[model samples]
Every structure is written in structure tokens, then in C-alpha cells.
Target: MNIPKNHLWLWLPFVVVVCAGYFIIPSNTFVQELVAFGIMSLSISILSVFFKDWRIYSLVKVLGYVFLAFFAFVKLSFYNQYGVPISSSALYVIFETNSGEASDYLSNYFNGTTYLLLILLLWPIFFLLKGLFRKNKFQEKPLKRAFLYKLFLLLAALGCVFAIHKKFKTENIPYATLTTWDDYLTAKKQLKDALAIPTSKAFTKIESKDIPQTYVVVIGESTSRWHMQLYGYGRETNPKLTEIKEELVVMDSVITPHVHTITALEKILTLSNQENKAPSPNGSIIQLANMAGFTTYWLSNQKPVGLYESIPTIIGSAATHKRFMATDDYNYDIYDGALLPVLAEILKDKSASKKVIFVHLIGTHLRYEKRYPKMFEKFQTPSKDLKFQHEKAIIQTNRYDNAMLYNDYVIRALIEQLRRQDGYSYLAYFSDHGDEVYDTMDFLGHNEYHGTRPMFEVPLLFWFSEKYINEKGSIPKDIGNRKYSLIDFPHTFASLSTITFKGFDASKNVLDSTFVQRKRIIKDSLDYDKR
Candidate 1:
């Protein structure tokens, strides 16, 4: 021990650990924010220190760099694919740039710059280690070094195994295909690179117009109209909205293009379908809005940094953008009320014209208690799992129902403010998808148990002020069965603006009157292609 410590070679392990922390802390936060991540990173780095083979050291460095580089690119690619430009400055503030934010932020915006920095730091180390070992600078028994090396190998091995298991293992699996290291390498690298390329750009140039008026699009998370009393549900989940029934157009049975907000919003703003990522912006909502004359913006509570941030492009196109804004408050951590005032202030400028703002809420995001203020915690069910306790599941459902109550109120304020504005007031509200809470033998939140992805069944509402509604014409008030999804979003808006463009893909647009039948977004991959 003393000899290894005295030798410069002994410090290699310490370097590995320090470097690991430097890479992770600046990029990804953990479940409990970054404190937990630091502990985990230190443990893995120490494992590296225990290994003594020069080749093994090289493998670790190369593998870590390869993995981290893919990670950074995936984050970056996802951000850009949205066809929106998320401001690097806003990311720095929300992320604390150097300090980093919570583990939760990674799902929200593009911040892969940190990972790129990490890859740069490790490249030199990789070369140095390779050089050090090739020179045979340390004299030691191969057996002893090999012994140290195997122990170190065990740590790296375990880390890889755990990650694979977490992602691939399912509760009901008798067996699942074990993905190879090569598969992970290929998958992530492709994900990152595919998005980075210009081929994925999905929006048209939107020119800023005369007179600034902000159009706020509040994208609610995990809310279905069936759960809302405002739409014909039995419960009183939307007492505020129901009270003002005259102002609401609660579109019932509005299915979303994708179950998740990431994919659904992509369809809404980009005007693309489930078939592709950017590379085409012709009929996208962002393109349509820009063409119709309006500034587009996206503010989220999710973190998509790097490749993942591409989803925000639905709101920020080449023609329209104010950059994406996120609070990094996932898990419903940000209060539903926080977005309203910020929007109100931004819209106050009288000189601005037809500004379209999209607010992606953390509304009803997991760990239900955290979704609302502490006072709301009183509504937690008697049992946490609620697996066997039907009573507790019902209670948890009630808590979520209460959150819906809060959402209705929050939205009411936003619409009222818009009504007071001096322009053509219209509000098109839609949930990316609905949440199960406790339905179908499952606990709160969306999951596969709800048949495919639970996040796809969202509630969509398009509200117009009295002046705008009367000036135009009213949609048929009959409660006839009409299916709607985000695919109709572009067509619906285009109907209002009446702009024609070749990029518009109406081959599947549901808003087209001739297409009386509504189609489900999810396809039956097997069993005869029926959805």
C-alpha cells in the first residue's frame, strides 16, 4: 500500500474518481438533485482507481468518453429536433450553468455543452494513460497488478449491468433480450448525431409582426377531459371552469398524436406526424403560426438539454422564436401559479404584436404530494402503494382531482387576462396526454398499464373571446361525436388564418371536413395493423 502510494501511478485512481464527478455534476442531476449523484460518481471512480492494468485503464477512459459523448449528443440532438432554438443563456441561468440543477432538469431543455466539455477533459487523460502504460514506467508483478485490475473491472462491470437492468428489466419479464454494449453505443450515438444534423430541422421562418400581442399556449401535463367535471365528468374537478361555462370549449374525446408531451407537442407545433422528426416544417404549428403572423415561444418545467431539447422546437421555429425557457422543476415541483404572472408581465408591452407563448407545466408530474403546496399533502391516500387498497387508490385519485381543480383556476386567470387584451383574443389549450392517477389497477401517473402510453389521451380546449367568436362564427354546439388530436392543430389554426403552403400535410390532418372519421395516433404494430 505504502509503495503504491509513494509511486506516481497510485494517484491514477484518484484522478479517475475526480474526473467522473467533474463530468456528471455539471451535466446530470440525480433523483434527490446532485448530492446523490456525487456519491454515486465517487463510488465508480474509486472502482477505477483499484484497477491496475494499463489496458483496463485505457478501456475505462475510452468507454467513459464514448458513453458520455453519446449522452451529450443525445441531449443536444433532441433539443434541436423540435425545430426551435432554445437560448443557451436561459439554459445557463436555469441550470446554474457551472453549479448545475436537479436530476430532473435533464428531461426539459438542451444543455449538452457540459458533456462536450467533459469529453474534452477526458481525451487528454486517455492519451496520457495510454502513453504512461506503453512506456512501462511502473515495475510491478503482473499477477498483483492483474489482481487490482480485476477488482476494478468488477466495479465498472457492475455499473454497466445496473444501468442495463434498470432500463430493460420489467416486473413481469420471464426473460428480456440483454442489450450489448455495442447496441448502447450505437443507439445513443445515432440518437445524438441524427438530431445534430440539419436534416431534422422542422419549422419555417416566422416573421415578427406589427403590434406586439402575446398568445400563451399552456400545455397541461397528464390531464384528460373525462376526469374533468368541466367536460361531462361526474366529479367536480373543474369547479372554476364549469362556473364560467360560457367561456369554455372543452373538446371531448380529443386524442393526442403521442402519449408523451415530448412527442405530442412535436406534432402540435411542427405540423409533422408520428412518422418523422424535424427535417420537414411545412405544416407544423410553428410554421403555420409564423406564417399567420405571430411570435412563438416555449417555456417549460422539463429539462431536455442537448439532444432531448429538440421537442421545444414545435414552439420555436426558424421563423418564430424567443428561445425555450424552463424552470427545471419536474415532479410537479413548480406551482401551477408561477407561469401566469411571468406571462402577464411579458405581454404588458403595448407595442408587441400577436405573441404566441407555450407554457409546459409540471402539472401532476409524479410524487403527487410535491405537485401542489404542502397544504395539499393532506389529501395523500392512507396507503402509499395502494396496490391492494382500492380505498387508498380512490383517495389518491381525489388528490389528483384536486390538482385538476387548481389547473382550471390557473387557466381561468390566463384566459381572463387575454380577454382584456386589445387584439383578436383566442386560446387553444391542450394536454399532451392524460394521467391514469389510479385507474386500471395502477397507482397515480401515466404508465404502460393504461393500454399503450397513458400520456396520449389529453383534453384540448379552444376558447375565443366574445368579440372574436361573434365576429367569426360559432362551431356547431351539438355534442356529436367528433374525434380530434394534435394533428388537427395546424389545420384548425390554418382554418382561422387561411394560409396555404405546400408543407401542409393534410393527407392525415383530422381537421379536414372531408375526413369525417378520426384516427388513433398509435398503430397496432402487430395483429393486422389495426389501431
Candidate 2:
């Protein structure tokens, strides 16, 4: 065994690692990481003197570069998405997302700046590895003075760490990130396992009061009413819906409880309300309608492939019939119009006495270009007629309004199809949650921590066939003008389906005259009355 007497070159990897860590992480984290890396360097340098082979030293140098590069990449990506460092919540979202969601991000949100940042961060490490591997050998002999200098630097770093320790605690510096990842994965698995167990309980006390009919609930995605022409926006984004305004019952001042898809939909489909907000598996609108003897169908355009099933998928599984259009292709432009044909088939089936169909449309989720066909790209630029526009967000706003235009077509098509059916048909349309596509802020996606008002403000519309209106009497003239929250949806759906049970509350139903408007709550616990 030959040990190198001088080993100053061993300190180079430590310097690179510490410098890279400081740059990649947030400013608040730099001091703690610098101190940790300093201690690590001292331990490795002290132990390197006993090395038996020079090849081991070269291997260590290359591995150090790989570690630095990996850490930098993770930090950059996390910061870009969340505006904060990596944590348990961020890890949960990243690991739980399906492949389709991931593909959507890469194709749409992965811009040149992110790619350039990654390249800049990794280039130095690549250069170091290339040089080390080219020689096929590592520098083992280091000048004694250089070795002493490295030791002095470590001591200086330790002193600085002590100085900052009084001001900022170093509690989270050691393995918090890794622990958060592990905890998130474990919790997610437990949740998935829980949701997998069948929890649909038969309602012992339920009855149908009105004539059996086809009731359709069209759940849209990430569309705000602010972008729609039907809502008095300057853009002509809703040509179809606007033309048929006399036939539609457009609700006013409606907001969803949550800016997130799963959270908002769970409340909409279940007996969950603002006062008693708990995810109830057995009491979903689907279960109640099924208990009331209505044939249930769940038709969706969202991805059906993923390790962890989405809550919507879990709830949809209880339906009697299910059809999913895509197998995790989120980037491709398979328009929401595809669901219309499947819906045509469902409407064609006259075998059932009654039917309750849940049509989940991928309406205007991110990558707006993929949501609609090219023909719906009407608002590409600022028009001379429309006044409200921002240069920074105009292009994105155009794409979003274009998506809304496409949404208008698909929704109206569903309504027209139901009208053509020979029965007391009814339809309700509402978005899962509104998006922040340059509405009140220059932001694009949901922000759970500080969500904006436009993030909750959504559109809720209804279309009742002439037969149902004539039989059940006209829908309250003021039903469309009522201010309501998405939490009222389950009760309203019950009214639309005419399913009466112990869980039915007319006061919470938006369509009922007894309906009461209260302070809207968001993110489960925040009061949004003033916002």
C-alpha cells in the first residue's frame, strides 16, 4: 500500500461542491450548506492519506461532480415550479403526478431559460469529469503548503458557521430534503391504498320524486368566466354560447371552493359542504343517483394510466359504465371535442329508464394550445374592439380565450344533443376551478398558498329541455342570477336528478328558491367573503 504524502488536489472537489451548493440553493440556505460541506471536506481529506490506490481518488472526484450536478438540477426545477426550496408538499405533487401531467409540463412549460440554467449548472461538472477521465489517473501528490492552506480554509468556514448559528438555526440543514421525500412517498401510498378499498354504501333512505330523465353533469377544467364572451368579456370567445344565450341559464357570481382540480371536484361530487367538509365516499352524487335507480355513466378525457389513482378516477369507478379517451397523452392535441362522439353514443342508448352521466372534459388545462382544435384559435392577438388587455400576458390570454372558445363549442354541443333526445333531459356545466391566466395577476397556474380571486371565480351554466321545464315548472327566474359556491353543487345535482333523500338540503341547492348564499370558503378553511 503506497500512500501519497501530499494531497492538496483532494480539496478541489470539496471547493466545487460547496460553491455549487451555495449557488443552487436559496440565499438563506447557503451558510448552513457551506458549513456542512466544510466539515465533510476535512473528514475526507484526513482519511485520504491512508488510501492504498490512486484509482480510488480519481473515482471519488468524478462521483463528487455527479452529486453536485444532481443537487443543482433538483433545486433549480423545484424553485421554478414552487417559488421555494424543495419540501414535503412539493415532493408529494411531483411524485403523485401522472405521466400525462409530466409530459404536459415538459412539452409546454419547459422553456429555453430552464434548459439554459441546467446546462450552465452542469457544464463545470462535466468539464471536471472530462479532464479527470482523460488522464486515466488522479493527482495524489500535493504540496505541503497547499494542504495546510486547505485546512486553514476549513477552520475559517467553521468559524463563519458558528457566527451565523446565533442568528439562524441549522436544524434543517442535515437530511430534511431526503426525509421529506420519504415521508411524502409513504403518505401517498397509504392514501392510495385507502382509496382502493370499496366504500360505496347503499343508501337505505332514498326516493325519486319526479319523472326519470337523462341528467348530465359536464365538469370542465381550468377555465375562468373572466375569459369568456358570454360573461361580458370583450373577446368573442363564446360565439356559440352567446348566440344561444336565450336557451342557456347562466349563473352569476359563482366561485369554486378550491383552486385545485381534485379538491374542488371531490366537494362537487360528494355530500361534502363548507360546514361539514370531509371526503365522503358513500354519499357522492353518483352513489345517491345510483341508489335512486338512475343508470350512472362516467365518461372522461383525462389520462387513465398512473401508479396512484386520482381521486376523480376513484370516485368515477363506482359508476356503472366508464370510458376514458386517452392513455396518458397530455402533450398531444386530442381536443375535448372527442368526448362529443362518445356522448352521442350514450345519448343514443334508450334502454335505461333514466340515466345520470358525468362527462369530465379536459377543458382548458395548461398547454392551452392542446385543449382545442386549430379552428377555435380566434383570439390570437389584441383586437381593435376589445379593450381589456395586457401586453405581458396578452399572448397567453389569447391562447386561454381560444381554449374557452373551444370549450364553448363542446359544452353547447352537449346541450344540443340532450335537447335532441326524446325525454325530460337536463344538463349542468361548471368548471372544476378557475385558472389564473393573467386575470388578476400575471400568473398562470394554481397557487395554493396565496390563491387569487380569479382562481376561484368560475362559470356555472344550466340547460333544461322544454319537456322537463314544462313538466316540473319553469326554473326559478332568479336561479341564474344567484350568487353561489361550488360546495352547493352536490345538492343542486340532486335537484337536477330529482333524487330526494336524507342528505338533500334545499337551502344549499343553487337551483332551489330556498337556496342561501353565505361566505365562500376556499382551501378548506379560508373565508373568501371579502375577496
Score every model by TM-score: 0.58, 0.78
Q: What is the C-alpha lDDT profile of model 1 across 381-497, one tens digit per residue?
A: 343433346664666676676677677778788788887775666776778777665544343444322333335566777667666566556655443246665655765654444
- 168-263, model 2: which lDDT tens digit per residue? 233222244556667766644543443433334534567796456898999999888878887888878888888888878889789998877766
Largest lDDT belongs to which candidate? 2
CA lDDT, candidate 2, residue 363: 92
Report the C-alpha displacement of residue 501, candidate 1, in angstroms: 2.3
Model-by-model lDDT, in order? 0.51, 0.70
Q: After superposition, how far is residue 170 of candidate 2 from its true place, in Å?
A: 13
